[model samples]
Target: MGREKRIEYEGAIYHVISKTVSSENAFMEEKDYRHFIKLTCDAFSKYQAMLLSFALMKNHYHLLIKTEKANLSQIMHEINSKYAHYFNSAHIRKGHLFQDRYRSYLITNDEYFINAFVYINLNPLEAQLVEQLEDYKWCSCRYFEDKDNAPRCLNFKEIHNLSGIEIARITQFIMSKVSESKKYGREIKEHNSEENIKKIREISAEIQNKYGSIVKNRELKYLLVYALCSKKFKLVDISFALKMSYATIRRIKNKVEKRMTSDAMVTEWLSEIGKVNAFDYQNDHKVPGTL
Candidate 1:
């Protein structure tokens, strides 16, 4: 079969969804969900992708983002690939961890953006998991209230700007949506309930038990993300592409870099990870991980 045509969405708004492979639970606990947020907060910056809003549910995640030159494919790959690696080690499972390709819907209309935003935000309420949207501790519903940011990552300013609403108004809008909410998408509820959260704790504990032994390097993880997003490279060439210290990469992955013998299969994998050609001078001047 021919490859499906990718939707052209450069500098356009999109609603992206990624789910767990085998239709099982992806986020097993509150911290798992927090990791999802932290991952995106880091991933988005490195990719130059912009997040408008995002809502994390039990089995899947919703991301509303804008890409200038980079495509949705690369962003999701960075997320799914790294998260899968972490999840596999944590769960002691192997093979593909996420469903084939994440779903991306172009936000061509204003109503749909609002609908998507509301739909994602109301995930907990729709599932009857909570009486108030703010009650869902994993979401960013409370961020606008300036009370505290939910565990998940969200770039809330764009949606607020587009709606011409201030933070105060945004908080009011969220509360109003919750007040008028019904059974729409109520299926997002956490099922198999208590066992699920406990199971997550067990899995996380196992991973933590092995984390010191697993010895992941932060720089290597960064390199993998960078290499996964890069199109051309021999091992030496990729090695040269780094301005960051290899020791740092090794420290990041907590492992030595492996030798690549040109398996010929990496090209397609890299191709799936789209690239961005744009340059930002301001960013170039900034130090790594420094705001």
Candidate 2:
């Protein structure tokens, strides 16, 4: 069987979890944690996603994300791929870093959202990694009290609006334990029901379908490079896919970035292609849960 298709849409919230391959420590030192966090912030900004909360464990990490666009896969790809590249280079290692594609649970309502928030913050305590949630240096719990020092990627205001919990009370709420039953099996039934939104289309295919032949269209080729890069496709992989040289791919990407600022038409074209690049999941089922 093939992997399950991820359900994605604008404004969708998810509890995303990714573990290192073979349960190895993903963060070997303080610098590792800092670098991962920096990469995460950059990815969020580049993809226009909002991070509500996060907890980084030794082997695994949890993230509560509310995507403003239907580009969760793209966002995660950038973060994971970039971090894996950095980690492998820093440690003089190679091969896969993560065990598999990250797992995500759709959060459909405020109740489940709050539950996930608390659940993520409590991971350290549940694993006996820390006696106090605030003492966990890697989690977002401590940032609730020190917003000025928190990563710019974290959206505490959105968290308050969605969870209906005030920013000031968030730390207190997380510290208070909820029922154990609420923690497990709380994800909705629709999470298990899979429906094909659309088959994954390559950047070349999308460009060809939208703009016809690109053999002589220099602008379209640049758009292709931009779209592929936005999806976190490596330069070498893109070169193979487009039958272009590595230097040409980088040149096209640079050109696209420059054009985006000065050319409105170019910017519009890229924006339209971005929507095409995002996963579109049509879900009508009501998510059941209560606080």
For each candidate, what TM-score against the reference?
0.57, 0.63
Q: How much lDDT does each candidate structure score? A: 0.55, 0.73
Colliding residue pairs in candidate 2? none
Model 1 earns a TM-score of 0.57
What clash count goes with each model? 15, 0
User: In model 2, what is the error at residue 269, expressed in angstroms?
Assistant: 51
The total number of steric clashes, by the backbone 3 Å criterion, in model 1 comes to 15
Per residue, candidate 1 scores C-alpha lDDT tens digits across 49-135 of 777766677788877787766467777888888888777777787888789877666554455466556666676766777886666
Compare the candidates by lDDT and give the number of the best one. Answer: 2
- Among these predictions, the greatest TM-score belongs to 2
Model 2 regions lying over 4 Å from their true place: 1-4, 180-182, 185-291
